[model samples]
Target: MTMTVVPAPAETGHSVAPPGRNRRVRQHWGATPYLFLLPALTLLGVFFVWPAVTAVQLAFYDYRVVSPAEFVGLGNFSHMLGDDRFYTALTNSGLFLIGMLPILVVIPLLLAVLVNLPLRGIKVFRLVYYLPVVTSMVAVAIAWNYVYHQRGILNWLLNTLGLLDQPVQYLLDPGWALPALVLVESWKSLGYYMMIYLAGLQSVPRELYEAAAVDGAGPWRRLSSITVPMLRPYIAVVMVLAALDSMQVFTSVFVMTQGGPQDGTLTLGYYIYDAAFRHFNMGYASAMGLVLWAILVVFSLVSYRLTRGKAAAR
Candidate 1:
């Protein structure tokens, strides 16, 4: 007897595709990795993207804590222009960048190069150099505070070295305060940047240096041609990081001087804190915070773009 093949009847509600036709469905189901990424995408949208959009919205309005946001339409931007405090913070921040950038960049690069040499106990030196990077910023700030105080270690050393007529109150003097803070920041930041440069330096091939030496290239020539060019990406990273950190400097200034000595050390970061907590001008403080963020964004973008151009050129 011969058996006949039978086809199943259609579903009551939904229509089922033929077996070969369901390949597209199976292909879609195979896209599980992207589905897994949906959670992270949602998180980024909620945290970073949402907050950024909100910040931009907040920038436009003169918002009050109790009252609804009053749409001021560039009023905050105009107000910031006439704000002497804003100008002061801008100036101080600029000065800080000027003072700290060179030291932070050059010293770290130099240190990295030196430590990367085939010398004895270089690992120990690397560890010693990196200690400050891991050390607590608060503890470092407090330690420096005492050291910078009148009759403290710094003053005592100055006096011992016969460099000062008296124990100068480093934080109290308007002229000295900002520089002092910059020095402290530089000291705290150097180790981290140095480590970064060290990592970058390690990737540089040894053959290049040997070839440079073979060609009668001196130390300066080798550094200028080989070391400097090779480290451009790292330099870019260091500069952008340093710029962002220096631009928003607050904690040390807040704890040490509280933007003291005639507001000499009054930075945008400090001003934002003051307007919010001290003066309770949430709208103005938010405006300033947004402005600070704008500055950071602009600087970072510019630096990144330029770095990309240089990298492309190479």
Candidate 2:
């Protein structure tokens, strides 16, 4: 052996397989993705899944924070249906959603299109439009609170313009409270939705627009024939987002009106907060939250189905 000593394979740059053999390696690499996903999956299970399950379970029981949780079995649902306040909140939520949907959806699309136009300083315009989106909701609510005040800048501006005979109680009057809140919510959300639409618009092929132009189609016609059809997914996304945001509207009502003036601005979201924190009915509040979640799920499913059906029809 000493007379015929040979170098070990480690010292030489030789391997068992041929060069570039890495390309022949199995690309699937099964189980690696799942292994990497384990931490996130465990966190989701512990944080979201378990809590949601417990909330649903507690919903069937009549358990206040201070009282024993007694199994009620749909009693909360029955009570909800029978309660006038619940009905009022539901109605207000419906009205708010209806009033805000068009503004939330249409305004953003228009803004996105406008900013996407081949014009100078469009980036500046985009920044201006997106400013509201990044602003804090609490700050937005507070600013709007002052604006809607009877003796605030809004009234002053109206007075300056001679638009009204006197100051209006925007948040105090039942007739105006919901609508006022809706407007503020739409304004705050418009920038975010507009950004989403902008991204979608950017993804749309410019060749289609050029082709439409070659075919002697005008801007509106091109939009109808090409832009709208291609943007169905984004539209669906906006609708669902607007609906969810509208359903979960709370901060504006809390800060601006506190769901006051005969509970005119009381939404389901506000009701949950009121029940849970204000009244200290934690168990009942959890039940209400579960019910709210069910309602939201139904609304979401219906909206999704309707939007998808329309898209499919085309």
Clash count of each predicted structure? 0, 0
Worst 10 residues of 2 by lDDT: 19-28
| Candidate 1 per-residue C-alpha lDDT over 131-156 given as tens digits, one digit per residue, 9 for 90 to 100 | 87788878888999999989799989
Candidate 2 lDDT over 1-314, as tens digits, reads 35866877767777566545654554446657988999999999999999998888877887777878889888877777787877788888888889888999898998888998989999999888788888988899999889999899999999999998999988889898888899999998888999989899998989999999999999889878988888888888888888888888888888888888899999988998898788876666777788778878987897789678877886
Please give each candidate's TM-score: 0.85, 0.84
lDDT of 1 at 190: 87
- Judged by whole-model lDDT over C-alpha atoms, candidate 1 comes out at 0.88
> Which stretches of candidate 1 lie above 4 Å from their native place?
1-31, 34-47
lDDT of 2 at 167: 97
User: Which 10-residue span in candidate 1 carries the lowest summed lDDT?
Assistant: 5-14
